[model samples]
Target: MRSSSPSPAPPVDLAKARRVAVEAAEAAGDLLRAGMARPLEIRPKGTAGDVVTELDLAAEALILRRLRAVYPGHRVIAEESGVNEGTGTAAGADAGLVWLVDPLDGTNNVAIGMPVYAVGLALCAGPVPVLGVVHDPVTRRTWSAVRGEGARGPDGAPLRLAAAARAGRADNPVLAWTQGHEVGRGDPVVLPLRTAVEARCGRLLQLWAPLVAWVMLARGDIDGIVGYRPELVDLPAGALLAKEAGAEFRALDGGPYEPSIDLPPAERGFVAARPALLERLLETTAQACRPAAAGTGSTGGTEGTGGSAGAGGSGGAAQGGRVRLTR
Candidate 1:
C-alpha cells in the first residue's frame, strides 16, 4: 500500500481570533470593574511585595471560560492556572493554539484605588503571538491587535507609534521603566539602568504597570518602555500590541522576544520602542549594566509625576499569582 500524505493545518481566521480575544477580555473587565467597588481581599504570594486579590481569581476564571468556550481544542497558560490542555486533546496536539491570560495586570494599583490596572490577553500559535487584547475597565478602553492587521483603539481607530526618527531625539522624550517586584536597589542591573535612562531621556516615569505603559506607547503618549525581569504573563499581550502598532521589540541583549510558553522569565529584561530609538535604547541599557561610575548614586531622581510603589503604586510582580483552575 502507498504511504498516505500528511494533512495540512487548518486555516486560522485572525479577524475572528481578534474578536474573541476582545470579547473575553471585556468580559473579564466587567468582573474586575465590579470587584473594584468592594473592599479588596489581598494577600502576599512568593514575597511580601508580590500580591493577589479575590478579583484576580474571579476575572481569570471568566477569561478562561470564555476562551475555552470559543476555542474548544486550544491550550491555555494563564497567570493563575499554570497550564491546561484543551478538552479531550493531547498536550502536544493543542500546542499550536495557546491563550495567555493575565486577568489583573496590576493588583497593587487596584488595591490602592489607582485606576492603572487592566486585563491583558494574548493568543499565540506555536511560538508566535498572533492576537492581543488589553482592556482597561476604568477607562472603558479596549486595545486589540492581530499580527499584520495593525493595532486598534477602543473606538476602532488605527493606532500608530510616533515616528522613529523623532523618537530618537533627546528633546523632552518621556521613557518608562519597571523593575521586578522582588528586585531590590542593590541589583547591579536595576540601579545603573535606571540611572542611564534618567540621564539620557528628558523625563523618566516609573509605572509598575506594564500594560498601561504599553498602551501609552501605542497611543503615542509615551516615547518608549523598558521592563526588567518581566514575567511571562506581563510580556505577551503588550509585546504583540507594540509590534502591531509599529514599535520595535527585543530582548535587552538585542535578540527577538520569543513568545514561547516554555521560556523562563527574562533575565536581561525587554525593550520596546520606535524603530529608530531601539538601537540607542539598547546601547544605553547595555552600558548601564557595566560597572557604575565612582560617584554614581542609585537615586535617578523623582523628576516625573507618578505615585511611587510605596504609595499604592506597583511596578509589576515577579511571580504569577493567579489561582489555577484545572479543567
Candidate 2:
C-alpha cells in the first residue's frame, strides 16, 4: 500500500479545504458503494430504534483514517467516537477547524436493501460550517456546497439556486422532514404537508439522512428540508452549503441552528425551506405542536396515533398535535 501524505496546516485555505472535502467525500462514497451488496453484520442499540452494523463502524473508520491522512491536525466530531483530535475529545479549544463526518447516515436503509442512505461530510470553521458534501453512491450523484459559492452537482455543475428562491408553489419546491422515527422529545414541530403542495409539481423524495436532504436542497434538486436532531457532524457542512446555495434554513420552529465547536451534539431543532413559504411552514408546524384546536381531534388529537419514543404518551400512544405528513 502507498503511504499517505500529510494534510496542510491551519489557517485552512477555504479553496483547499473545499477541494480536499470533495475528494475525500468521493473517496469515502466509493468505499460505501463497494460495500453495499454484501451481507452486513447488523445489531441493535438502545431500543429497536437504534442500530449499528459492521459496515457503519468500518465506514466511519475508513473516513477517519482517510481524513486524517489529508488533514491530521484538523479536529473531528463524529457519532461513533464522540470527539477526537480537538481538546481531549470533550473540551473546547481554538482549533478553528473541524470536519463533521457522518460516514453513513442511513445505515439502516442501506443495510436493508433500501436506497435512501447516503454519506455526509461537512467542514466547519469555528461555529459555522463553510463547506458541505453529500454523496449517494448507489445513484452516483454527488451534491456539494461551498460557503458563498452556491451548491453544485457531481461534475461541479453549478445550480441556479438563488433564482429558485422566488419560485412559487406552482413550481413545487421540494420539501423534506426529520427522520420519521428519530425526532427527539425536544422536537416540537412536525409536518402535515399540504397535499396541494405535494401534488403541484416536481419530485417527492424522502432520503432519511439530514445531510443528504440538505445537500439536495442546496443542489436545487429538492427545494427544502427540515430536521431537528442534527448534531454538529450532521449540520455544519450542509448548513453552509445551503446558505451558499441561497436556500433559507432555520429551526423548524424558526430558531438559529448555529453549531458550536465545543458542544457535544449540536442541540436539535432546524429547518430549511424556500423563503417564499418558510414562515408559513414554520407556523404550520408550530400549530401542530399545540393542544388540539378544541374538538379538532381527528388528525391533531389523541384520536391520532403514531409517535416514536418520548413523544409524550402515558402508554406510548402517538402524542402531540396533527403534524404527521400524509403525503
Please report how far candidate 1 places residue 249 from its true position, in Å.
Answer: 2.3
Q: What is the lDDT of residue 209 in candidate 2?
A: 61
lDDT of 1 by residue, 1-327 (tens): 000222213246777878888888888888889887889888875543566788888988888888777777787777666676787654445547777788888787777787778888888766556778989888878998777668888999988876743544545668888655545546556666777888888877766577878888887778788766555665667767877788877676566664444443334266778777788888887666544322333212111211123211232222333213233
Model 2 TM-score, 2 decimals:
0.71
Best TM-score among the predictions, by candidate number: 1
Query: lDDT for model 2, on a 0 to 1 scale?
Result: 0.55
Please give each candidate's TM-score.
0.81, 0.71
Off by over 4 Å in 1: 1-11, 89-92, 164-170, 255-262, 292-327
Per-model RMSD to reference: 7.9, 9.9
On lDDT, the candidate that comes out on top is 1
Q: Candidate 1 — worst ten consecutive residues by lDDT sum?
A: 299-308
User: Tens-digit lDDT track for model 2 on 207-315?
Assistant: 5566666666665667666543333455566666666666665554456544333332223445566566566666654444333223342222222222212211010
